[model samples]
Target: MSAHVRTPGWFTVNVLNRAVAWTARRGISVWGSRVLAVRGRTSGQWRTTPVNVLTVDGQQYLVAPRGHVQWTRNMRAAGGGELRLGRRVEVFSATEVADDDKAPLLRAYLRRWKAEVGVFFHGVGPESSDEELRRIAPDHPVFRITVTN
Candidate 1:
């Protein structure tokens, strides 16, 4: 049997989740998009979470803080969903970026979110993932959503 290390879930999650809440409240935005719409695999509930939208070469993506989080799961399950940027909502098909580009993407993500990443990383050093993100994520899977706007 393979053993999986569980993601950190103590005070760390509490704090980072608050940031997520903040983004959700203020309608946080990135790359001109303020929200990510991921559907529930089983229930088909359309869940929109305010996320740091990162774009690379014109491709839009959400670098999930926790890879194993439901958002990623749904992204994988659905492969395509909707994105709401202001009142414009459009459907997009998602594809997971392979590990080869993880480092580059991570660096781009850090650049777009250095302040929050600073708070998130704390003392993890520039070479490490923040505890919250590292908990369920460290090596992350990038959810690239194709957009035609």
Candidate 2:
């Protein structure tokens, strides 16, 4: 794959995603980390992607439902970027959290997502419990983005 895809799919995020981000900004939904808009590493275009965020002991972390994809790719590409929390902006560093820590981080995710998160855990049969999915995919990567502080 070339550095930049340049396809429409690569250029934009759909409305549903925008809504999640908006709600997060408004504190209406715990779904997005407000919005982490990273500059495209190659294209230099700004790309805003929704990510579920958590403040662990005052340090910030974000984890995606998807194991590895565009949003994650964008995060990896930038290494980090500006994180918008309400009216405040802070620089952040992106680190892919180790697999062994996925459980605790995912626990934070489950708390925030509740019923809304099932679709992402597709591997778990609808009847399967969260515990089941946790057991099955305990090694999935959870990316953590923390403020440079």
Candidate 3:
């Protein structure tokens, strides 16, 4: 297990994810959920997982609440991926956000999905101080993405 990754529990992996993926597959988005599809760095085959898309000031982002997980690693290597919502697939390019710049975004993310992903943030919530957010920023890799297709 990587130091940056925090593995989710059985319930989240089996039950919650499946439910979200199921709904997103059929075109229903739950709290900005989307099935992110990117190619594996080594295998070169497409890999996917459910992710929350955060939009602030018209810009879109993907924050890895689970730390540097597989999809985040893959996204770094692939430099882009697809956001799938049922029959709608939007291809996009991704740029990793600097850790220094993550605090505000993370705060906004917490403001929106704290109930669901806050646990992964290690007690940090929307109300956390900027210093507190920055302390954990590296553990949560954030990406700024733009849809190209």
The weakest ten consecutive residues by lDDT in model 1 span 1-10
lDDT of 2 by residue, 1-149 (tens): 11322222432346656766777666564545566778787787887766667766666777666455566677778888776656666688889876555566666666666465545555453345557645634334466777774
Residue-level lDDT for 58 in candidate 1 = 84
- lDDT per residue for candidate 1 within 1-149, as digits (tens), equals 11222354665557755556455456554434456777899899987665677887887777764445667778888897777655667778888876555556666776767665544433333356544334323445677778645
C-alpha local distance difference test of each model: 0.62, 0.62, 0.93
Q: TM-scores for all candidates? A: 0.67, 0.68, 0.96
Candidate 3: list runs displaced more than 4 Å. Answer: none
Point out where model 2 deviates above 4 Å.
1-14, 23-32, 123-140
Q: How far does residue 8 in candidate 1 sit from its true spot (Å)?
A: 10
**For model 1, which pairs clash?**
7-135
Candidate 1 vs 3: which has more TM-score: 3
